[model samples]
Target chain A: MTPILIALTIGIPWLGAIIVWLMGDRREDLTHWVSILFSIGAAITSVLLLPNASQETALTIPIGGDFGDFTFVADGLGIFLSVIAAVIGSLAVIFSKSYMKGEGSLGRYYAFVLFFIGAMVGLVLSSNLLLIFLFWEITALCSYALISFHNDDPKAVKGGIKALIITSIGGVGLMVGALIVYAYTGSYDINNFLANYSTIPGNILALLAFGFLIAAAAKSAQFPFQTWLPDAMEAPSPISALIHAATMVNAGVYLLARFYPAFKDVPYWSEAVMIVGALSALLAAVMALVSNDLKRVLAYSTVSQLGYMVYAIGTGSVYASQFHLFSHSIFKALLFLSAGAVIHSIGTRNMLEMGGVGKKHPLVKWVFIIGALALAGLPILNGFWSKELILESGLKNGPLWLYIVMVFVAGLTALYTIRCVWLVFFGEPRSDYHAHAIGWEMIAALLPLAGAALVSWLAAGRFSVLLGEKSLPFHAIEPLPYKEMMHEILSLPTLVVMAVITAAILLWVFRKKLEGLINGLKSIRWAAENSFGFEAINNAIVKVTQSTAEALRVTQTGILNWNVFGILASVILLLAILVLGA
Target chain B: MNLPIPLVVLITILCLAGIGLYCLLITRNLIKVVIALQLIVKGAVLAFILAGNMTGQLNLAQSMALTVIVADTIVAVVGLALAVQIRLKTGSLDIKSLSSLKR
Candidate 1:
C-alpha cells in the first residue's frame, strides 16, 4: 500500500503531464483545471505517504543488471520534501490559472510543471544513487523547458539555456559522485553506502563529498552559481515560486542534509559548506538590497535564505536546515506568487514603476506583507522561528566568522525585505502604470500560503519528530518539543540577531540621513549589481567555449564520408588498443 | 595453416567490417552509405553470434543479434527514404548538404 501510494505520488503528476499535453492549448480552462486536479491529487498522495514513513525502503524494482535496483525510501527527509514539492506545486498551478489565463502554449507550461513536480518527488524518494541522478536530471530538464515556455522571447530562451547549462554542470558533479559510490561499493544504495562509506579510502571520500557540494551549490544557486537564478526570473512567477523558491532549489539543501551523516567527518568539508553558505547569504543580501527589479530582489533573497539552510547543514544541524527548508518554502512561495500578482496586474516587474500598488490591490498588499514579514523574520512568523533555530545552531557549532556573517545576512535580509516592500507598495505612485484587477484564483492561492507563513512554525515539533533519528538512523536528529524549542530560541544569539535586524530597519527608516554611509558603500553596491564578478566569470567561460567550438568547426566537415571516416578512425583506434597491450 | 573456428570467424568479421569501412570512406551517395552501414552491422551481428557460441549462450546471442538486425533494417529504410526525399528535393544524390550540421 505504501509503495502504491509512493507510485501514485510520482505517477499521478506524470500521468497528468501526458494527458494535459495531449489535450493541447485549445481549451485553457480545461488545461488549468486538469493541472490543478492532478497536482492536488499528487499533493494528497504525498501527504498520505508521509505518515507511513520509515527507515525501510518503501519500494524496490529489481531489473537484475548493471543499472541495479531502483529503490525508494519514504523516510522523513524524502517524505517532507515530496510533500513540499507536491503541495506548493499544486498552489503554483492554481496561481497560474489566473496568472497564465490567456497565454499561448498552455499545454507546454502545465505539462512541464506537472513533470517537474513528479521528478522532484522522485528525486527525493529514490535511494539508489543512479536512480536519483536520473530523477535529478529529469527535474533539471523540466525546469529548463518551463523556464523557456515563452520561447519566442530571446531573453527567456537565453535564461533557460543558461539555467540548463549551469544545472547540468552540477548534474555532472552528482553523476561523478554516484559513479564513485558505484565503483567503490559495487552497488548504488545510499543507505548501504552511508553505513559502509568509512571503508572507502579518505581522499576518494573527500572527492565525493566536494563533488556533491559542487552539485548542491550550483543547483541551489549558492555563491558563484547564483547569477543564473535572477536571470531565471524570465520564467513565469508561479514557476519562480514553484521551481526556484519552493521545490527544486530546495533539492540542494535536501541533498546536503540527507548526506550530512556520511560527509560529517570529511576534513574541512563542513567549513567549506559553511563558507559557501555565508558567502551566498551575504553576497545575495547585498544584491537584493540594491535591485530595482521586483522579482530579481526576491530571487536574491531566495538565494540568501537558501544560504541559511546550507549554513545550518554546515553546522551539522540537519533538523534546523530541513525545518528552515520547510518554513522558507511556504513563505517564499507566497512572496513570489504575490510578486507575480503585482507583476500580472501592473504589467511590469520593475519595482521603480510600482509604488502605491498596495492602495489599488489591498489583498495583494496584505499577502505580500505577510510573506515579506516572514521573509524579514519578524516575531511569531515561521521564518523567525526557523531562522533563529538556524542562527542558534550555527553559533554553537559553526566557526565564529561564518556565524557572524550569517547574523549580518539576517539583518541584511530584513533591510532588503523592507526596502522591496516600500519600493513596490508604499509611498506615492512612482510611474504612470495602469493596474488590472486581481484575479480570484490568485487570491485563493495567496491566502493559504500567507496563512502558512504565519503558522507553519507550529509544526516544528512534529517536523523534528518526522526527521528524528528513529526514522533516519544515520542522522542524529532529536525531536524538538514546541515550548522547549521556543525556550531554546529565547537566548543571546536570538537577541543579537534581533538587535541586528532592528538596526537594519532603523537604517531603512532613516535612509535620507545616511547619505554618507550609502555613498561609502557604492563600490559594494556596484559589485552587487554586477553579481560580484560571477557574471563576468560566466561570460568569460561562455566566450571561451564559443571560440573553442568555432575553432573546432573544421573537424565537422559534415560530408557523410568524412564523418564516417572519423567514426571508423576512432573504431580502429579502439581495435588497436584491444589487439595490442596499451 | 588450419585456423580454429573462433579465429576463422574473427577473420571473417574483420574482412566484412574492413570492406564496410572502406566503402563508407569513399561513398558520396546516401544509399551507398546506408549499404555500408548495413554491411558493418552484419559483421557485428555475426560477431555477437560467435561470442554467444563461445560463451554457451547461443539463445541470448541470437536474440540480441536479431534485435540488432531489426533496428538496423529500420535505419536502412529511414536512410533510403531520406535519400529519396533528398534526391527529389535537390535533384541529386549528394550527401553533403544532408549530413553537414554546420549552419
Candidate 2:
C-alpha cells in the first residue's frame, strides 16, 4: 500500500503536468481547474502515505550494477516533506486560479509548477543517491523555468539564469559526492553509506561531508550563495510561495538533517554548519529590514527562517530543525500568499506605494497579520514554539557565541516582519494607486495556512514520533509528548528570546525618538542594501563563466566535416594509446 | 596475393570508412552526408563481426550489428526528411546555407 502510494505521490503530479500542458491555453479556465484537481490528488496521496511510514524501502527497482537498485523509502522525514510539498503545491495552484487569471501561457506555467511538485516529492522519497541527484536537478530546472516565467522581462530572465547557474553548482557538488561514494562502496544506496561510512578512509570521508555541505549551502541559499533567492522574487507570487518559500529552499536544510548522524562527528562540520546558518539568519534579517520591495523582504525572511532550521540541525537535533521547518513552511507560505494578494491587486510590488492597503482588503490584512505574528515568533504561534525549541537546543549543545547571534537574529526577525507588515498594510496611503478586490481563490489559500500557523505547534507530539528512531535509524530522535515539548520550550532562554523579540518590536514603535541611532546605523543599512558586496562577487563569477564559454565557442564550427574529423582524430588517438601500451 | 579472411575484411572496412570520410569532407548536400553516414555504419558493422570472429563471440556481434542497422536506418530516414524540409524552406541543398552560425 505504501509503495503504490509512493508511486502515486510522485506519478500523479507528473501525469498532471502532461495533462495540463496538453490541455492548452484554449480553455484557460479548464486548465486551471485540471491543475488544481491534479495537485490536490497528489497532496491527498502523500498525506495518506504518512501513517504507514516505516524504515523499510517502500519500493525498489533492481538496476543490478554499478549504480545499484533504485530505491524509495517512506521514512518519517521523506513522508512529511512530501506532504508539505504536495499540500502547499496544491494551494499555490488554486491561488493561481485568481493570481494568474488572464495571464498568457497559463498552460506553460501550470505544467512546470506540477512538474516541480513531483520532482520535490521524488527527491525526498528516493534513498538512492543518484536518483536523488536527478530529482534535485529536475526541481532546479523547474525553479529556473518558473522564476523566468515572464520570459520577455529581462530582469525575470536574468533572475532565472542566476538561479539556474548557482543551483547547478550545487548539483555538481552533490553529483561529485555521490560518485565518490559509489567509487568507494560500489553502490549509491544512501542507507548503506550512512550505516557504513566509517569504513571509508578519514580524508575521503571528510571530503564527502564538506562536499555535501557546499551543496546544501548553495541550494538553501546560505551565506555566500544566499543572493539568488532574493532575485528569485521575479517569479509570480504563487510560484514564490510554493517553490521559493515552502518547498525548494527547505531541500537544503532537509539534506543536512537527514545526514546529521553520519557527519556529526566529522571535524569542524557541525561548527561550519552552525556558522553558515548563523550568518545567513543575521544577514538576511538585516536585508529584510531594509528592502523596499515587498516580495524581496519576504524572500529575505524566508532565508532567515531557513537559517534557524539549519542551526538546529547543526546542534544535533533533527527533530527541532524539522519542527521549525514544518512551522516555517506554513507561516512563510501564508505571508508570501497574502503578500501576493496585495501585489496582485495593487499591480505593484513597491511597499512605499502600498500603505493603507488594510482599509480595502480587510481579510487580507488580518491574515497577513496572523502570518506576521508567526514570523515575529510571538507567543501562541507555531513559529514561537519551534524557534524556542531550537534556541534551547542550541544553548545546550552549540557554542555560546553562536547561540547569542541566533537570538539577536530572532529580534531582527521581529523588527523586519513588523517593518514589512507596517510598510505594506498600515499607515496612511503613500500613493493614490487604485486597489482591486481580493479574489476568493486567494482567500481560500490564505485562510488554511493562517489557521495552520496558529495551531500547528499542537502537533509536536505526533511529529516527533513520525521522525523518531524507527524510521531514521542513524538519527535516533526520541518522541516527546506535547506537554513535555511545551515544557521544554517554556524555559529561561525562551523568556530571554521573547524579551529580545518584544524589545525589537517596541523599538520599531518608538522609531521616531531614535533618529540619532538610526542615523548612526546608516552604514549597516547601506551594506544591507548592497547585499554586503556578495552581488558584486556573483556578477564577477558570471562574467568569468561567460567569457570562458565565449572563448570555447570558436571550436564549435557546427560543420559536419569538422565534427566527424574531430571524432576520427579522437578514435585514432585512442587506438594509438592502446597500441603503444601493448 | 592470398590474404587471410580477417585481413581482407579489415581492409574492406578501412576502404569503406575512408570513402565515407572523404565524401563527408567535400559534400555539402545533406542527402550525400546521410549516404556517407550509412557507409561508415556499414564499415562499423563489418568490424564488429571481424572482432567477434577473432574473439569467438560471433553471435553477440551479429545481434549488435542487427541492432545498429535498425538504428542507422532511422537516422538516415530522419536526416533525409530534415534535408527535404530544409530544401523546401531555404531552396538550397548546400549545408553551408543551413549554418546558423553566420548571418
Best by DockQ: 1
Per-residue alpha-carbon lDDT of candidate 1 for residues A194-245, written as tens digits (9 for 90 to 100): 9999999999999999999999999999987998899899999999999999
Candidate 2, residue A177: the lDDT equals 94
DockQ category of candidate 1: medium
Q: Give the TM-score of candidate 1.
A: 0.93
RMSD score of candidate 2 (Å): 2.6
Q: How do the candidates score on chain B by TM-score?
A: 0.91, 0.96
lDDT of 1 by residue, B1-103 (tens): 8889999999999898999989999988778889888989999999999999999999999999999999999999998998899899988897776754577
Per-residue lDDT of model 2, residues A152-192, tens digit only: 99999999999998998888989999998898877888899
Question: In candidate 2, how many clashes are counted?
Answer: 0
